[model samples]
Target chain A: MSFDVNQLFDVNQLFAEICEEDNLFAFEGTITSEEINTILENVEARMAELQIDLKHRKKIYNITVECIQNLYHHSDMVPEPLVEKLGKNYGQFVLRRPGNGYFITVGNFVLNEKIKFLSEKIDKLNSLSSDELKEMYKFILNYQKLSSKGGGGLGLIDIVRKSEHKLMYRFYPYNDDYCFYRLDIVI
Target chain B: MDTLSIEGTAKTPTVRFDASKGLIELKGRSIPENSIEFYKPLVEWLESYAKEAKSQSTVNIQLEYFNTSSSKCILDIFKRLEAIHKNGSEVAINWFYDEDDEDMLEAGQDYESIIRVPFRMMEVAAG
Candidate 1:
């Protein structure tokens, strides 16, 4: 099956919807390592203007780094077909403040074949309590080899632990070849 | 051998590994996209430092924030130090976190649990 490039995930439409609410910053396009640095700088500047305490601000910033870098690392795993259409490392992220806590939503494309593993990973992370997650993080840190793409399989676990919230995720079927993976983290 | 000094950037940390004083200080953020690449020299330097045999080695890590990838590389460094400490070099790791930053403190404690080297959790005033 095939899907229109725009139909994969409408970046502009997503931002428009989020902006109408309480988005502090939003970006949708190719995310390079350099771009990640720029995005983090903007996030830090934006967070500085808020009334958040030091701990919360660091939590939000650390989570933001993991979220965006997750998108960046997963870019290589996207099927060649999707990479051609979306460009390598194409991803989007929105930082919003709705009610009391801040919301960070990061999205990227994943090959269909990898969906099961990704889903199971997130589900397992969401199932664990805070203490369990902490133990898992330490275990991975001590044991796991850092992937060539620069992930220790600790991003999702760290996000869940630091946020102290269950990770919210969805895998939207873009086509038979790829699925849009979105992670919504509350901080 | 000689001292290893690398300036910090927007995404990487400032690394200073001095062999003479047996002082290794890693300050600033450590969120480089390619953490393995960024930390390779420091790890190699530590490997060399291990052989030279200073009776005491002190490592001060005061990172404002580090990504998960960097976290792993940081652990790699600790593992090397653990080996050094096991070999009878007095290795002391002082992990500095801003006051009230429980996550950073916990991160230190986690490493302390994993590695045999003694770790001192230092709380500093938030800047």
Candidate 2:
């Protein structure tokens, strides 16, 4: 099966649906650290308008930071077949309000071979109880060495733990050699 | 030794470590893309301070939030402070969070359990 957006996906329809979701912000294509910072500032300013308490505001903000950072850490160049349509390391992230809480959804490219490993990883994290999650977080914090990207593979753990909710995700085949890894966190 | 202070930014935290006064503080959000780079000086300062730290050193951490990358750097800071505590100086880590921020309190508890230094979780009234 192929995952070519030009034929298999409708970019305009997807973008239009995203627009109707009460989006606070959405960024497509290349995302850098500086760009992430700018988006964080924009989200913070928008959340401030809600006049909610500070604690919740900080949670949503922090989760948003982690979500966007995923782009920098996990984004892969689109497969050659899809490169012209998707560009290199191009991803889509949206912060929106669909229900009582905010939703942070991000979709980034990953090499197709990585899908199984990532799938099991997220599933393992999702299956743990809250206490187990805490233990895993500590174990990782103390024992696991930092990766080249400066993460101990704990971002998802921290995100899931903070939101105290499930880490919802999906994997869409973007091409023969790439997959679209989509993650959604509600806070 | 002189005091060390760095202003906070949208991506990094503010640090105030007064060597003579035995007071160390880190406040604000820490989500820098390269937290190791941002926090290298603070860690190095603490390493030097541990050599001749005062008899009683109080470290205050009032982070609104920090990313996972910053979490490791924060742990590094505590581990260095642990050296100071083990070296015979009385060290107290005061972790402050908004009254309603249970997650922040839990974060403090996690660090307290991990590090040997004394940790005081101070809850400020929510605004």
Candidate 3:
């Protein structure tokens, strides 16, 4: 799983390029608990400054919380090859106003082996109707054990539920052993 | 027993639990990164309070937003209240939501459906 960071394009550069259209904020690096708090505060302040309605602000804020927490957990699963250069829990996120609604895009490096599992999870969530998703959320909340990181496997489901939109994602292969995972959430 | 009063933070909620009057109040947002860690003391308080339970218990939950992990911890809190109710004390759970937040209302309903304890969904104007 050893590969030079030069083989793939710089993650920060990629984020900057894609987020040029009305990007509110784009951040790349380690995402720790402290960072999550700061990010949430910033998002809230920015949305409030725009005078977004309470309902929409709450929705966007909740979605952002789940997205950043997901990144905090999954981003740590970085491939061994890039660990030195990227560091643990390396992640990036962009929040922007692309059009009528807000969009949140989060990216992280992950092992290739996890790509299938993550893809299937999102696809299954996208396939279900709102009611079904609610049921699934309740089922997991009642039965699943929270991981050491305090994740109950309900982050993605909560994101889809709040957004009321299909979950969109992409996995760009960095090498045979690792892939840069990007998830797009519309709110 | 000692009363539990914790001021809310950016990531946690304000908690006010009084065993003498059997009153519990949880207000503000609950989006802690580690919900269990933040809620363990409160949960432990509930367990001990359940033993010498009062005749009537009133619980008020007012939350702006809670992450998935907090949601699970919330359910655990409800279950503990349900036990107290099943053991012969009267327990009333008031779940307050913003007037326009259907999701919060539904979340309260979902918890009511699962836990045997009675719940009153109160709609409040968004502040």
Candidate 4:
């Protein structure tokens, strides 16, 4: 059997690239519920280690929970043809402290058809003033039946309200029918 | 209707609903991935209790945190309770939020406005 030195170099390069943007933590792969548990605990522990105030720590934790679980509900597994090329079911989840507040970035594979709905959702949410967002949140809370995903867009609203900022989003075409949806929540 | 008590875990909340005593208490964090599974029974219990209630019920919610899915289920419970209240049964919901947690307080207020089941927001010492 021939040893592949270049493959090792390629793997190391990938690790370095992931580490470049997020020195704190970066995860890319299947995010089972069990994985979410461990990731949350580790994040909590890290925040404690950093001596972050409880309130700030919890805000970070809550936003992270919503972002990752958004994966469980929204992200489709990479189709078989794309698995070899894509590496995982979802895109990378990076938590980093670039300057002041923490940056949480999560990406996943979403059907191209969903782009309009998602983009419009964010656009409408962004258009609202803080007061309007609260009213809209309550209005949706009162009327909307829980979607099959078990939430009626409350995750997005919560993310916006907690961060108190517009969501930064990007859709990179993954293939003919799917696109990689990346969301950035800063807090 | 009987009392329903479910112990809490890192991911789920503790529920204490005693029909006999007219006391309903939900404390601890509720972030269960399948909130539907965790909250369905409680909602059903409230539905059943609403059928044969003879006294005032007090619901005490002192949650540190809960996720979006749990929010829907929580509202379901509140709506059921509102039905009970509308049927001439006295119902009071005391929403307890940590003094420092405005998000939780706002959540309780949002529920209060929508449920019509008179909510009292109380600031409690952080636990």
Query: Once superposed on the true structure, which residue ranges of model 4 sit more than 4 Å away at CA?
Result: A1-19, A84-88
lDDT tens digits, residues A1-187, model 4? Answer: 1223333223224435646874577777777788888887887788888887766776888888888788877666664566776556455677788787888878787777888898999988889898998998888777888877676678899889988888888766656676667778888
DockQ class, candidate 2:
medium
Query: 2 or 4, which is superior by DockQ?
Result: 2
Q: Choose 1 or 4, whichever is better by DockQ.
A: 1
Candidate number with the higher TM-score (1 or 3): 3
Q: Mind sharing the TM-score for model 3? A: 0.94
Q: Score candidate 3 by DockQ.
A: 0.81
Q: List clashing residue pairs in candidate 3.
A: none
lDDT by residue for model 2 over A65-170, one digit each (tens)?
8878878777766667666876666778788887778788888777778878877888898899999999999989988877768777888999989888888877
Flag regions of model 3 displaced more than 4 Å: A1-9, A79-85
Highest TM-score, which number?
A: 3
Give the distance in Å from residue A65's predicted Cα in candidate 2 to where it truly belongs: 0.7
Query: With candidate 3 superimposed using the best TM-score fit, by how many Å does residue B31's alpha carbon deviate from the native?
Result: 1.2
**Model 1 regions lying over 4 Å from their true place:** A1-11, A76-86
Q: What is the model-wide C-alpha lDDT for candidate 1?
A: 0.85
**Tens digits of lDDT, candidate 3, B1-80:** 99999999988999999999999999999998889999999999999999999999999999999999999999999999
Query: Which has the greatest DockQ?
Result: 1
DockQ of every predicted complex: 0.85, 0.71, 0.81, 0.65
Worst 10 residues of 1 chain A by lDDT: A1-10
The stretch of ten residues in a row with the least summed lDDT in candidate 4 chain B is: B31-40
Name the runs in model 2 displaced over 4 angstroms.
Answer: A1-7, A10-15, A81-86
